[model samples]
Target: MSGFACASSCGLIFKSKESERNVVSLFQYDGLRAVESIRLGAIRCDPKSSISTSAAKCGRIKAMASPTVSAPKREKDPKKRIVITGMGLVSVFGNDIDMFYNKLLEGVSGISPIDRFDASEFSVRFAGQIRNFSSKGYIDGKNDRRLDDCWRYCLVAGKRALEDASLGQEVLETMDRTRIGVLVGSGMGGITAFSNGVEALIQKGYKKITPFFIPYSITNMGSALLAIDTGLMGPNYSISTACATANYCFYAAANHIRRGEADIMVAGGTEAAVIPTGVGGFIACRALSQRNDEPERASRPWDKDRDGFVIGEGSGVLIMESLEHATKRGANIIAEYLGGAVTCDAHHMTDPRSDGLGVSSCIIKSLEDAGVAPEEVNYVNAHATSTLAGDLAEVNAIKKVFKNTSEIKMNGTKSMTGHGLGAAGGLEAIATIKAITTGWLHPTINQHNLEPEVTIDTVPNVKKQHEVNVGISNSFGFGGHNSVVAFAPFKP
Candidate 1:
């Protein structure tokens, strides 16, 4: 016999009809949704029929003596419901999200010739460059000079997100500052600064290195500085997972709110790795496209003639909050953050596992975490970076997880934005969320020759209207990092 272990009454509450020794205890009173709690109970017990006999033996069932008394369940906790309240971005297409996605749907390429530092002599001479970026409201002239471009991007994105969420200084003062957090991240934080510092040290001397080198170059400073500026005393940190950096930050920030560590989180990723060193390093590994003549078509994911990924740089951020918190504040919720997951291939440092085990498992885990069924998802923002092996590997992984399902449609955002390394996932997430709100899926663009192995819909070459109830975004990184995040349209 099994029963509820209450302080007043601890006795067997349930038993199989065939045997007294076969006692099954039902775990009770979960804070999850009704369906999930029901699944955990595993067995049904009617209080009128089963508990009546044991009512005298166990007093806890007296309150549950109704005929409809089934397995234990509880109401869904509002604190666990994570929702997106605001979004902010810095991209080559444009900082305004509507314009950015519109250009993407129109099959416009952000990749162009790199002018940041003369790259005419480099192996690959092109990249996705954001024309002009400024953080006037967030920082002063002196501080901007001291900080790296990556840090400046983080500050601007965070400020824009707060403004979008209406959590400016006047509004933020009303909330509990201790329960707010910042989770912004970067894969190659201040790469330009590091490269400049090294050059200074080599050409001049060790004394020539700037005093701001250590402070601005570290990855954690992005989140730390945001926390300092906003007075968010809660969890603050950064995650560096190469291209998966943004999704990893999103996953961690959502959980921080879900776990009650914070009520609101400013989370996302940023990067500015288009320096000469950045271009040369990838060129050394032969990981960049060499189509200097037709840079626009160089980042052709799944194309037969595609060479490699085009490096891009930008920042993307989202203000995340528990549904209860946002609703209490009357904040305008943009979308819902359903769930997300992360994994490591452990098969190779730079390449994915040939069998595609890691990516496939991560997608399934993300779906399970979101408590969503396979049929509910209609769109996926893939992480194909236009590489020969990478595109097929991701598609093969998708096939394994979502086998024989014609309902799902996917596209590669890298075709337009190029690969932003850490910031790619952030920008792609904004694109996916845009689809949920606008009912449009951006085209994968340059797929003149689609690979035969990809049986699913690639949404090639043209943007189309599709009602998207649920969407998921994928981002894979060097060092075999795999991350997936799920989203749903806000119901209420």
Candidate 2:
């Protein structure tokens, strides 16, 4: 008995020359020509067999070695890697970063009745409104008095971030001012200023409009003013992707550092949209929660009783720098900006895709960009705005990427802070990084009755102590914009 072997995934072995010859003859047919070619190229027929043809190339087949699979390329070079040196925010909890995160971990609700203006007439009367926010030290008296609250929030938050980064007046003098940039964004830019200008023009005359109205009311003004104050000449701009604005800013800012355009970037978002027109606008769209009776529970995400999202106002900012620059200056590295991604649903204007394909894809792409495996992510700061369609839609999207939800502890920071629109991602990112540093995951408060479809451990109504390996902060905006940003503890 002579042996023959074919090894190109056919994995066939024949014990007799007659059997091999018969198979070869069969494969030689017109319909099986491709198969015959593969077999001829990969097979070893018995050497002494008379039926073995030269065309068969009867030689021992060497098994093809599997390609060596290596790990994905992550940013290891100090110049390319981005680190979060400092964080600052103008949150309803307060302007202090620690205080803001502590308030969240304590499960405190910042939502309350909108007392900024008379809201008794509006259908939705409550929101995550910041009370008595002062920009005494950050902005001068003249500018503070004239600037819109949106601009004030941006200025305060941006300056505070610089202070947190140890980039103070004295320290900044030593660094390259030209290599620094600002990218703070706002979704609804200076609505108060715009509203006041419009009212002035309508009620009084066009001459009554303030000269500063146009400059302060524009979205790019925040970033421009911040850059002007700091003397930064690098890439300075604003992004307005609704609620995903902050994450988009983060992504863009990190890219600036990665591309060697800037060594440090003051990036995040701010929005003070709790004014009359702001509230009236959302009310017109029917997006605000009407839970005026229970303001504390108004932003309940993933809860079956959730009605709609609570509109909040504030700013959240981060100081991102290249690792080389940070380490050279002995800067305090708070966390590593692993990577992030943005995707558009291209489906609806205000509503997320019920199937959640866009969000799931965004999450997946973010991991790939971060050079992180799905299993590495242990915590998710979800954009679970308590709207009926949005909450379950985000949960469904999350379930698609993470197969085992047991290890993943997800929570919605918006559950307590309410949705900050343009500032939401930045605030949530601070929460995520805090969770990484503190090993404490904040609760998705007001989860009294969870939606049946939400299977992930939401850390419902109570914070949990979990060592986070990798955490992601998600933020989705109107116009079908979805963003996911990954953060991890700095290893080096």
Q: Which stretches of candidate 1 lie above 4 Å from their native place?
A: 1-75
Clash pairs for candidate 1:
2-13, 3-13
Question: How much is 492 displaced in model 1, in angstroms?
Answer: 2.9
11-43: candidate 2 lDDT, tens digit per residue = 011124454556542112111011111111222
lDDT of 1 by residue, 1-492 (tens): 000000000001122343345543231111111111101111223334322222211111111122442422211477988999998888897677788888887778998999888887887999998887777778889989888888888888788889899999888888799999999888888887787888999999999899987778888898998888888898999998888889999999999988889999999999888888777877765667889999999988777787778888888999999999999999999999989999987865565665677888899888878876555677889887877667777777776766543656689898888888778888989999998888777778878888666666677776656677678999887666889999978886
TM-score of 1: 0.84
TM-score of each: 0.84, 0.85
Question: Listing every candidate in turn, what is its Cα RMSD in Å to the true structure after a full C-alpha superposition?
Answer: 18.5, 20.9
- Report lDDT per candidate: 0.77, 0.79
TM-score of 2: 0.85
